[model samples]
Target: MSKKITLFAKIFSISFLFMGCGMAVFAQNKTEDENVIRCGVGLLSQSPTIFTKKTVSNVSVTASCSDTTVYQIPVVFHIIHNGEAVGIGTNIPDSRLTSQIRILNEDYRRKEGTNGYNTDSRGADARIQFVLASKDPQGKATSGIVRANGGQSEWQLSEQAALKDKSNWPKDKYLNVWVCNLKNGAENLLGFSSFPVNSDLDGLPTGADSTTDGVMVCYKYVGNSPLSTRYNLGRTLTHEIGHFLGLIHIWGDGFDCTSTDYCNDTPAASQANYNCNTTYDSCPDAQGSDMTANYLDYTYDACMNIFTQDQVARMRTVLCGSIRRKTLWSEYVPQEEPKSVSMSLYPNPVTNSNVIVAAVTDNADVTVFNAIGQKILQKTFTPTADKITINLPEYQLAEGCYFLKVVQPSQTKTFKVIVQY
Candidate 1:
């Protein structure tokens, strides 16, 4: 089978419902661990998310945001632990947090050579990038990884606002992410996120209140933790962030075949998918098979790799239209400089011929790194042409994943490359 698993190609005309956004709690890949988040599957036995009743609007999604502008949003993580030592339990290490950010960028930007990269025509780079806040609300330098003692072992789902309030930041300025113990009695809570609301037109209630306006992810699923198993690969946050940015579950969670996610490109499915079962088609009436590979679905992290073009259009619309999210892009006066230019990589899973291609719009410095961040190859480009090609056989590197970084003055973009030969 082709690596690109595209389900349908026909354009779908969907009446985008642009009102009443709310919270979305997700239950991803089931794991054998004690702290399993039962977002309706094992323990909850109910809908993992409580979707708000959508209202009709004639707002054209594509009209709101059309430029290829990469919106970079600043994010802060509040690590709430129960007096555990740093790097233990809920008090996760810095590496784990950074890894989660890396996964987010890979998924949102569709960087090559990562699990997030996909070739399906439906798949699109959201043209969104997440930056860990280098400055705190107090204008002080911060790692964006704030560690504090929540003074509790585990929290209940009802305490969403309370926990967030304990370590709060302005939601308009920073995309707040909470990492803590949420293994409720009889079931563990994986993660949940607040949906975006377009409050510019008529006053509509966003799924989340100001107290719970960001994303809350269980400590276990925050990063590439082995204990998470099927839920690993840091996709829990990716999924929740989708909701945070105005995406609905592909299944619709409406308990019927007629349920729709408002994105025309995504086919209707009856229910959520678990693990990597991409073959199952819940909605026979729909044109495409279940989008098991979509970021909005309940499939395992490794199983999912795409967000259709319309989905991308919807999210960009939300960002540009939503009152809360519209400010997020410009709220942070960065301690870390933003990337001014971007580039793309091709033939990831590098071919046997070992020719690598990097395309940029401006003059750039191309460098290659091994699995570990070691610089193995370096070259510069003046944009005499838009494409730069390099032969990898000269380096004689082993068959594995590597990083290709392109630097253009104040901007930098990195692509992951895989070697199969």
Candidate 2:
């Protein structure tokens, strides 16, 4: 909720601007203490404040507001680290990235029974989905994740232009997000994203679409974990993407009632609420109370769960109008969730008998690999019911960490499984 509400209704040419980036939209204040956890959002100068040569009065938003088609966005996660090993320091593992992606789908889709679900009448399924880029700009197959050594320990928010140069794909083709140590001194800033510029404009900053367009996220907050209790759920990225897609803070980035986020459904809040508390009413005089649960606010990960109809309209409109955004979905072919993406092993130490529990919808080839990269077992298993339970009884040889690989027609995925005696 750091940035003030600023969205251009038209992607016109010859207009100048930035969003005011009001949520303190470009900066996040990290807490210094170990026991206490907190974060803050701040405004930035390079931020684009205005766009649209002139408001296109005839544009219709009816199709956007009632859009039922689930638009898929191709995203490229650039892991910028100082040569840290996988799963260490700023270089996070693929599973954590997968976890973060799953959370994005859950939150954006608002699937029931998940943390992303909410009962609010204004709550909506944005219908916009995210997919890792399956192919690179040069027409090469990729995981959509680019990991590189930045040769630096940390990056400054002001240096985003240079930081992005470390490993960036074409912005008009993919949604690039740099995950690294955004540590200014000892503080850990969560993340920030540059607002989308109208490509139809001229006389703007040179290479505006390529230079200052993308997102920045700290490594610790890239994925979900109980250890990251306050910002644990990966909602940080979700909120920033809301900005990337054109949704501003619910409070309008001010205490005055006249300020607005441009969404009619969201009730105006006097200020941003950072905690999980939701009953506070910053604006009683307004129609409804504060929409603390709205993803645009700086609420805790757990407190966020909804995107209103109007908010969805704003985002979809951006996707349609912004030249840098409208074609991102075409960068990759969308596929259904991987089968057995996250396999769970029962009874920590794998003995003579081990059970694999997961939500597998179709047939898949399963293979178990030892720690040394040798295949220990290979079998074909088909699930007969919604709840899948497969038994593997060959863990007697060693007591250590192993991996399970699942191969399907569409994709191949691996999971970490522990074997014990």
Q: Against the unseen true structure, what C-alpha lDDT does each candidate score?
A: 0.71, 0.68
Work out the TM-score per prediction.
Answer: 0.67, 0.67
Relative to the unseen true structure, what is the C-alpha lDDT of residue 386 in candidate 2, on a scale of 0 to 100? 31
> Against the true structure, candidate 1 has what lDDT?
0.71
For lDDT, the strongest prediction is 1
> How high is the lDDT of residue 20 in model 2?
36
Candidate 2 on 277-344: residue-level lDDT in tens? 66767666778878888888877888899999878877877677676888776422457865445444
RMSD of each: 15.2, 12.5
- Candidate 1: RMSD to truth: 15.2
Q: Compared with the true structure, what per-residue lDDT tens digits does model 1 show for residues 239-307?
A: 888878767677665544655566667877755666687787777766788888898887677897888
